[model samples]
Target: MFKRVTVLLGLNADAVADHAKASATVVKILRTLTTTVQGLAELRNQLGLGHGRAAPSPALTRHARLALNSTVTVTEFVIDTWQDRIDRGKLPPCSQ
Candidate 1:
């Protein structure tokens, strides 16, 4: 999911990788962000609501808050990147 979104937003590392103009920091940050989200997805699959649990969830309020905050940060970053691409005309106008 992260890769797909990254590609759609023109944030794919391949676009910038192997290019002298690329920012190493940006690529590293994106990779880290994707890994963090992937970790969150695994946490959700294991302890989050929806999957049948024989007992109570092990998650605490702090855990939920962390996940929520991480989600918001990731979402905002992706949206900002996408808008930046559109603004620079690297991407075409979004059609609803």
Candidate 2:
């Protein structure tokens, strides 16, 4: 998902693993966003929300909440950046 977002922004890399070869700004954002997404993924797994584990996973309410917030922040940043590009005509408008 993060890769898709970056690609839409015109970054060449397709995954976080390729961050090492990306430009400085791309690498920086990818590193930070990658950490946030990883934390969110871990929380989802531990909470048994997406993982195919049995019910009654260990509860970490506070930590999970924080992770969810972080996830939203990161997601919004990518979305807003994309929208800004469109508004500024840096990116083409969506076709009907």
Candidate 3:
């Protein structure tokens, strides 16, 4: 998903060696967003939500809810930035 986002932003995912690259700004934002998503994935795994566990799980606490909200916010920002670039003709429209 991160790779796809980078590509959509006209960045070379493979060429991103560091945050100082030409596409660093957008890449860094995407990387941070990716990390947030990864954390959520890890939390899910820890809660046994990734596998079929017979044991019942506890309810989501405040921290979990905050994490979910943060992830959504970052995702929306990335999508909005991409769309803004497209709208400004800075990026090509996605191919059908």
Candidate 4:
């Protein structure tokens, strides 16, 4: 789904992330965030309690904490970038 984010924004996913990291276009690189979001999806699908798994989750408490923190990081980056675009008059005018 995070990969789709770049697409929705009319960007090539891998290219934009690579460029962001290499060019320092923004304050920080976002390539690893793709991996983090993907990993979280896999972990939740395979071992999450909601999946009705028979075995106990191999994910430790620390791992879950890290996932939450990573999610927050991604969320903040997205919001900040979105606001930056609005500030720069890059995004289309809001209907409202």
Candidate 5:
């Protein structure tokens, strides 16, 4: 007999830990994308600010650069791992 459960319970027929890991991976990618875009926007805003009015603080520039770099690295690592797993037949194609 089939049973129904609320999504709130987060039940899955597939390996629960694998499902969770996959979800976390996707979330991390999305978060990194959002952060990278936001960082770039902030950097642009700092550039647009006139030099006469206080210069873009070095700290802000440094922080933005660091965030952008981290996001890029994280995204690349996730993508590579996902692709490698799929290529090696370790993971099935994800479907919605």
Candidate 6:
């Protein structure tokens, strides 16, 4: 989600305020998702099976983690790449 948002922000590189707001929203959503992940993990632990709880099938977990890591990497890449423009008042002024 954050990476998607970051990509969108980069596409709007000529617009500053909108990009700032979009970045803030993405950060908020990421925080919320992190919290949700923790809660889900707690719930999974609480519902342990009588015979050792089965792990998520490796195939499913593998791609899910990879996707998540990829997203974070992309988000950081966007942030690092454009942060100078954002800070130096280089982005174009918002329209309308």
Q: Write the per-residue lDDT of candidate 3 for residues 1-96, one digit (tens) a residue.
A: 765776676543533445466566756766777778777777778774548777866646886687779878877876876897799798888899
Q: Of the pair 3 and 4, which is ahead by TM-score?
A: 4
Models 1 onward score TM values of: 0.77, 0.65, 0.59, 0.66, 0.39, 0.34
Q: For residues 1-96, what per-residue lDDT tens digits would candidate 2 score against the true structure?
A: 776677778643433344555566666766788777877777676675555676665767877678778978887877777787799787988789
**Total backbone collisions for each predicted model:** 0, 0, 0, 0, 0, 0
Compared with the true structure, all predictions reach lDDT values of: 0.83, 0.71, 0.69, 0.68, 0.54, 0.54
Worst lDDT window (10 residues) for model 3? 10-19
| Shift in Å, residue 52, candidate 6 | 3.0
Query: Distance (Å) between predicted and true CA of 80, model 3?
Result: 0.4
Clashing pairs in 3: none
User: Which 10 consecutive positions of candidate 1 have the poorest summed lDDT?
Assistant: 12-21
lDDT of 4 at 8: 53
User: Which candidate comes out best when scored by lDDT?
Assistant: 1
Of models 2 and 4, which has the larger TM-score?
4
What is candidate 4's TM-score against the reference? 0.66
lDDT of 5: 0.54
Worst 10 residues of 6 by lDDT: 7-16
For candidate 1, lDDT tens digit of each residue in 6-89?
878867544454674566667787888899899999999899866776777799999999999999999999888888888988
Superposing every Cα of model 6 onto the true structure, what RMSD results? 11.4
Local error of candidate 2 at 28, Å? 3.2
What would the TM-score be for candidate 3 when compared with the true structure? 0.59
